[model samples]
Target: MVHVILTHEVKDFFAWKKVYEEGEPLRTKSGIKMTGVYTSVDNPNQVTLTGECASAELVYRFMSQPELKAAMQAAGVISAPDMKVLNKV
Candidate 1:
């Protein structure tokens, strides 16, 4: 399995969450098997998302899609995202 970790800052958490929910179909279609979300206790706008996928290549493709970038912009993401893909040992 492949694990994806993403961190970013959003202008509004609620708005970002709404946009995120709207992208469920795309995410599923991109081979996301499971996901978990977390927010920073010190800064609510800081968001972290972890996803499990069938392969790192699939997750990388998903992240590179133009639609995903548009979605993030529409979701009010105010900062560039940090992402990492890991393979299960």
Candidate 2:
């Protein structure tokens, strides 16, 4: 299994959380099993989503979709997301 970590800052964490929750269908379709959602210790606006997918390709494809960009915009994400795909060493 591959792990995907996507972190970013949002304009409003609560608003982003609402949109993120509504994206369950998208994540399911992309074969992404989200394991956790987190916020920075000092900043509630900083968000991180952690999950597992079949491969890095799946993650890239999911991230590249226009729907995702739209969702991010709607969620008020203010910064470019930092996404990393990693396998256990």
Candidate 3:
């Protein structure tokens, strides 16, 4: 499995979490598995998460979807997310 680390800022962490939780089924259908979420110690609006997926390629494809963009926007993502995929060493 490949893991992706994603970081971004949200207008409101709690509101964003509500949307993220609601979107779990969509992610599962796309073959993405998520871990517990996280935030900066000093900045609750700054969010981060690690997700496991079949491949880095799948992660990019899922991220590029228009619906995903819409969902992110609705979820209060205020910045373009930075994501990196890693394979266990």
Q: How many steric overlaps does candidate 1 have? A: 0
Q: Which regions of candidate 3 deviate over 4 angstroms? A: none
Reference-based TM-score of each model: 0.94, 0.97, 0.96
Candidate 3: 10-residue stretch with minimal lDDT: 59-68
Query: Candidate 2: where is the Cα deviation over 4 Å?
Result: none
Please report how far candidate 1 places residue 33 from its true position, in Å. 2.9
Query: What lDDT does the true structure give each of the candidates?
Result: 0.91, 0.94, 0.93
Q: Could you tell which candidate, 1 or 2, scores higher by TM-score?
A: 2
Error of 3 at 46 (Å): 0.3
Residue-wise lDDT of candidate 1 within 1-89, one digit each (tens)? 88889999999999999999999999989988657899999999999999899888898889889999999999999998998889778
| Model 1 RMSD, rounded to 1 decimal | 1.0
**Order of candidate numbers by lDDT, starting with the best:** 2, 3, 1
Candidate 1 TM-score versus the reference: 0.94
Instruction: List ranges where model 1 is wrong by over 4 Å.
Output: none
The TM-score, computed over Cα atoms with residue i paired to residue i, of candidate 2 is: 0.97
Q: Candidate 2 lDDT, tens digit per residue, 24-65?
A: 999899998999999999999999999999988988898998
